[model samples]
Target chain A: MIVIENVSLSHRDTPILRDIDLSLPRGGITALVGPNGAGKSSLFSLIARLQPLQKGRITVDDMPVDTTPSRTLAQRLAILRQDGAVANRLTVREIVGFGRFPHHRGRPAAEDLALVDAALSEFDLHSLADRFIDTLSGGQRQRAIVAMTFCQGTDYLLLDEPLNNLDMFHARQLMRCLRTIADERQRTAIIVLHDINQAASYADRIVALRDGRVIADGTPDDVLTEDHLESIFGYRMKVEHMNGKPFVLHHL
Target chain B: MPDRRMIVLAAIALIAVLLFLTVGLRGNVQFVLQLRALKLLALLQVAISIAVSTVLFQTVTANRILTPSIMGLDALYLFGQTALIFALGGFGYASLDAGTKFGAEVLLMIALAGALLWPLIRTRMDMNLMLLMGVTLGLLFRSLSQLLSRLLDPNAFAIVQTASFANFNMLRADLTILGTIITLAAVVVSWRARHVLDIVGLGREAAIGLGVSWIRTAAGLLLLVAILVAVSTALVGPVVFFGLLVAALAERVMRTQRHALLLPAAALIAIIILVGGQTLLQHGLGGASTLGVVIEFVGGLVFLALLFHESRK
Candidate 1:
C-alpha cells in the first residue's frame, strides 16, 4: 500500500497541495481526477521524488519515500509525467531499454534485453524500435514512454495525465492497455486523468481533487454522482448509468 | 561495432603516426625534431582536453551548443595568471619554478570552478541562470584581468600577453606533464560517471525518475569538466567553441546517445583535428597562420551552423 500522511506542499509561498492524507492499496486502477490547478501534477511530483518533500511523509510498501535510497524506491515505484521530453537523440529501443537501468545499471544482461524487447512488442513499437524518438508521432511517442515506464516492472505506476496529446482512439487504447496491465499483472496504477468518462469507464476507483484538497474519494460509481461532480468540477453535469457504469455527459 | 571503431581509430592513428614521422624527419635536423615533438605534444594535449571536456560539459547540460569555456573557465584562468604576474613582477614570475606555477594555476582554476559551479549543481539552479551567471562572472574576470594588466610594467604586460595567447610552441614541458595527469584524472572520473551521464542527457526530470542523484552527478561532472578546461587553458590558453565543434561532430558521426561511445568518439575527433591541423599548419601552411586563429574561425562557423540548424529544425 502507498500512504501519504498530512502532505502539504507550497511553491514560492503559494500553497499547491494542502494537508492531504490518503492510503492507496495495491492491485487496481485509481484515477486521480481534477480540474486545472488542482495540484494533481504537484502531488505526483512529490510522490515520485521529482521534487523534495515539504511538510509531509509518504511511504510506498512501508518504505519511506524520503529516506529510502532512490535506486530502491525506483525499483518499487515508477512514474510517467505528462509531456515527458527526453532531449537526447535516442532510438525507441534504447529509450525503452533505460527502464531497466536500476536493475542492471549500464551493463544489460540477456534478461534485461528480453524485458526491453517484450516492452517494445507490447507497445506495438517493434517496427519503430530503430527510429529516433523525435521522429515518432505524438501518440506513438506517448505509447513508447509508457512502455518504458511499464518495463520498469514496478508494482505502483504513477502516470500524471497520460492522455495528453492523444486522440480519442489512442487514448482509449492506452486506457485499455493500462487496465489490462493492472488486472493481468496485479500492479497498482494511479493515473491522473482530465477526461471524466475515461476515468469512469477504466478506473476501479476515482479520487477527486479540488483547490489542492481531496473532495471526494470512493468507487467510480459513488464518485460519479451528479452532486459530487457538480461540487468537484463546479459545473452541472448529467451522469447516466450505461452498461453498469456511470457515463458522464459533460461534452456540451 | 568494436571492429568498426577500431578501423576508424586505426586510420586516424596511422595518419597521426605518419604525420609525426614526416613532420620531424622532413626537417632533417636532430634538435628540430625534438622541438617539433614537444610542440606536437602540447597541441595534442590542448586538443584532447578541450574536446573531451566540452563533450562532457554538453552532456551534463544536455545542450549541443555549450562548451566548458562557456562557463567562463578561460577567463578565470586568465585572471589567475594575470593576478600572479601582477603580484610578482616579470623577473619574479620568470624566476619561479614552472611546476610550482602550473600547480598554483590548476589549484586556482579548480577553486574557481567549484565556487561558481558547485552552487548550481547542489541547488539545481535553472540552466539559464547558470549560463547567465557564468557569462557574467567571465566578463568580470576578463575586466579584472585587463585592469591588472594595465597597471603592470610594459615588460610584465608583454609577458602576460604571450601567456594569454594560444601558442603550442611556448608550452612548458612540466606544464604538459601536469596537464596530462589532470586530463587523465578527468577522463577517469567521467568514465566512472558515464552511466549517469547517459541518463542525464534525458533531461532533468527523467534523470530523477530513473533514480539518478542529479545533484551529485551534475556536481561531479561539472567539476571534472572544469578541471579539463583548466588544464587546456593553463597549457595553451583558451580555445573557445573547440569542444562544441568536436562534440557536435562526434554526435553527428556516432549518432549515439551512449556516452561510452560519445566520449571516446569526441576525444578521437579532437586528436584528429589537433594533430591533423598542427601537421597542416607546419607543412601545408608553413606556419604562416596560427593554429588557434584557424581553429577559432572554424569553431565559430560550426557554432553558428549548429544554432541555425537547431532553430530551423
Candidate 2:
C-alpha cells in the first residue's frame, strides 16, 4: 500500500499540489485521471522522489519515503516519467539493464542478465533489444522505457502518462500489458492516463484530480457517474455502461 | 571494426616516448634537455587535465560544444595576473618566482570557479542560467584584465602579452611539478567517481532516481573540473576550445557513453592533438607561429560541426 498524507507541494511559491491525502491499496491498476494543470505529474514527481517532499509524509509498503535510503526506495518503487530524455547513446538492452543498477551497481551477474532478457521479452522488445534507443519510434521507445522500469522488479510502478505519443493500437497494447503485469505478477501500478475511456476500460480504480486536489476517488463504476464527472471536469458528460463497465462520452 | 581508441592511445604514447627520448639523446646540453623535459611535462599535464576536465563537464552539461574554459577560468587567471601587475608594478610582478605566480593563478581560478558554481550547486537553477553566469563572469574578468593591461607601461604590457599566449617554452620547473601533482590528484579523485558519473550523464532527475547523490556528485565533479582547469590554464595559459574539440572527437570515434572509455579516450585524443599539432608546427611550419592559434581554429570548426550535426539530427 502507498500512503500519502497532507502532501502539499509548492514550486517557487506556486502551489502545484495542495493537501493531497490518499491511500492506494496494493495490487491492480489505479489510473490517476485529471485535466491539464491538475497536478497529476507533480504528485507523481513527489511520490517518485523526483521532487523533494516539502510539507508531507509518504510511505510505500510501510517504508517511510523521506527517511528510507534512495536505493531502498528504488527497489520498492520505480517511476517512468512522461519525457524520457536519455543523454547517452545506449542500446535498448543496455538501458533495460540499467534497471538493475540499484541491485548490482555496475557489475552485472548471470541473474541480472536473465532478468534483462526477461524484461525485453515481456515487452516484446526482443527483436529491438540490440538497436539504439534513439533509432526507435515513439511507441517502441515507450515500450522500451516501460520494459526498463519493469526490469527494476519493484512492487509498485508509477507511470506518468505512458500513453503519450502512442497510437491507438500501441496504447491499447500497452494497457493490456500493464493489466497482465498487475494481474499475474501482482505488481501495483499507478498510471496517469489522459484518455478517459482507457481509464474506464482497464483501471480497477480511478482517482480524479482538479485544482491540485482529489475531486473524486472510487471504483470505476462509482467514479464514472455523470454527476461526479461533471463536478470533476466542470463540464456535462454522459456516462454509459456496457457489459458492466462504464464508458464516458465527453466529446461534443 | 578497428579499435581506434587503442590505436590512438598507442600513438600518443609513442609520440610522448619519442619526445622523452629526444630530450634524453641531447647529451651535451644537460640544461637544455632539462628545460625541454620540463616544457614537455607541462604540455602533457595541460593536455591531460584539460581533456579530462572538458569531457566530464560536457557529460554533466549534456552539451558537446562546451568546455570548462567556457566557465571563465582563463579570464580569471588573466585577471589575477593583471591585478598583481596593477598592484605591484611590472618589475615586482616579473621578479616574483614562477612557482608563486602559478600558485596565485591556480588559487584565483579555483576561487572564481567556486563563486560561479556555488549558486548552481546550492539551488536548482537551469543549465542555461549557469552557462549564462559563467559567460558573464568571463566577460567581466576579461574586461577587468583589459582595463588593467591598458593602464600598464609598454614593458609591463609586453610581459602580460607573453604570459597570455599559453606557450610551454617558458614554464618553470617548480610550477610544472606543482601542476603535475595537482592534476594527478584530481584525476585520481575523478577515477573513483567514474561509475557515478555514468549515472550523472543521464540528467538530474534520472540520476537521483538511480540513487545518485546528485548535488554531491555534481559539486565534486565541478571541483575536479575547477582544479583541472586551474592547473592546465596555469601551465598553458588557456586554449579555450581545445578541450571541447578533443572530447567531442573522442565521443564520436568511440561511440560509447561509458566514462571509463570516454575519459581515457578524450585524454589520448587531447594528447594526440596537442603533441601532433606541436610537432607539425615545429617541423612543417618551421616553428613560425603559435600552436594555440591553430588549435583554436580547429576547435572552433569542430564546435560548429557538432552544433550543426545535432540540429540536423
Top candidate when judged by TM-score against the true structure = 1
Query: Which structure among the candidates has the greatest DockQ?
Result: 1
lDDT (Cα, tens digit) per residue for candidate 1, span A1-252: 999999999989999999999999999999999889999988898888888898989999999887788889888898898998885578899899999988888888999999999999887889999998888898888888888898888999999989887778778878898899889989999999999899999999999999899999999999999999999989999999999999999886
- What i-RMS does every model get? 1.2, 1.4
lDDT of each: 0.83, 0.82
Give the least accurate 10-residue stretch of model 2 chain B, judged by summed lDDT: B17-26
lDDT over C-alpha atoms for residue B6 of model 1: 40
Which segments of candidate 2 are over 4 A away from where they belong?
A11-13, A62-64, B2-4, B16-33, B125-127, B297-313
Q: Write the per-residue lDDT of candidate 2 for residues B154-212, one digit (tens) a residue.
A: 88888888778778777777778888999999988877777777778877777767666
Per-residue lDDT of A46 in model 2: 86
lDDT of 2 at A5: 96
